[model samples]
Target: MTGFVIRQLGPADAAAYREIRLEGLERHPEAFGSTYEAEAALSPEEFVRRVVEVPTFAAERDGRLLGLVGLARESGVKRRHRGTLIRMYVRPEARGSGAADALVEAVLDHARSEGLDAVLLAVITEAEPARRLYERHGFKVYGVEPGALRIGDRAYDDELRIRFL
Candidate 1:
């Protein structure tokens, strides 16, 4: 953790972001809704657009992008007080290195700075480590969404978690 640095990612980081993200989608299909086939076809320009449009953060160690997280605020006036945490992933080699914690902390810090009232996230129910990680950061389980994501013939449940800031 001491050697890893978390920072905001921009268009310049499109390549690294794409690599890490594709890895997540491919290596753990059930953990994410997006499929590798869909993401792999996207052009570099699309990745650049994502970096420019989304508020993304990354944990880097020795020039390697190990973890990533994205935060998005609701657009509707009624839901503007809430933010969504999305696409959190840490390279397998970096797991248990506190990279996920650092990325989550960065998101929470940003949420506070933006005056968000709460932060929400949905994780696969089978992802025990991720569920525990969120719990350690004050995120509480609100509900379980059945059949939240389906890959081929398999359906995965998602647990909705929220933290009131």
Candidate 2:
């Protein structure tokens, strides 16, 4: 994690954010719900709006953006006690170097600071490394959503995990 900086992203980071995000969706279509084609069509202004609206954290090293993770809280009063962890991605070169760890920790820290009761996330059932990462951070699988995502003619299941703050 040395030389890596984990911080909240702003509007100025939209281009970099969009690049990394699209990379993730493109490189691993089965891992995310969003399609690369869908996101690629979005304008820079939309990314800027996302930067301002979502609580997203980015990992940077040597002035280059390496990864991103987003935290979203529920708007309903009854669901306000929880938040969702979304869009976690790290460049392949940065994997196992603690960049993913840093990004997730940043989200967990932010959740605690916001007084949220818990944070929930969904991982593709086949992604063992990601599941292990979340488990090591105290997340427990509560359920599995079979056929949660359908891409083309294939179906993918998602494991739902949650960690109480």
Candidate 3:
């Protein structure tokens, strides 16, 4: 497939997006802090509501979801100018095909439209590709949270990144 067709996610895409998310968690449990079981147990309504709240985008190729990305605005009044990039996942088979890049850009565009001053994200230290992707997009590692997520017997370090829009 050529570049994936990227589109803003709507309420109707909740299930498809959820499936991609679960697949990502299953394939790379160490990359993300979330688990497949944890996401699957959430009701569809919850998924839809979450999608509605955050600006989400999906990449599709040949009718299959290739990637998804979303951002959540900070809740506190003083921190409302900031937003965090979350739920960024690309199908393992679709890596380097531009799907993930498109999804990330779409979400970042949404954040810019919302007048966000900066965006933040936590990338697992060992995920070199992921870290490089963010760096390519002008994100710099501000700090690292040691032992961020405990997955089974081991712990993963997370690097905090920030990009000013």
- Which prediction has the highest TM-score against the true structure? 2
Taking all chains together, the TM-score of candidate 3 against the true structure is 0.95
What are the TM-scores, per candidate, against the unseen true structure? 0.97, 0.97, 0.95
- List residue ranges in candidate 3 displaced over 4 A: none
Span of ten consecutive residues with least summed lDDT in model 1: 1-10
51-133, model 3: which lDDT tens digit per residue? 89887888888778888888989999999999999988888788878777777788778889999989999999999999999
- Which candidate model has the greater TM-score, 2 or 3? 2
Q: RMSD for each model, in Å, please? A: 1.0, 0.9, 1.1
CA error at residue 53 for candidate 1, angstroms: 1.3
Which is better, 1 or 3, measured by lDDT?
1
lDDT at 38 for candidate 2?
Answer: 98
**Global CA lDDT of candidate 1, please?**
0.94
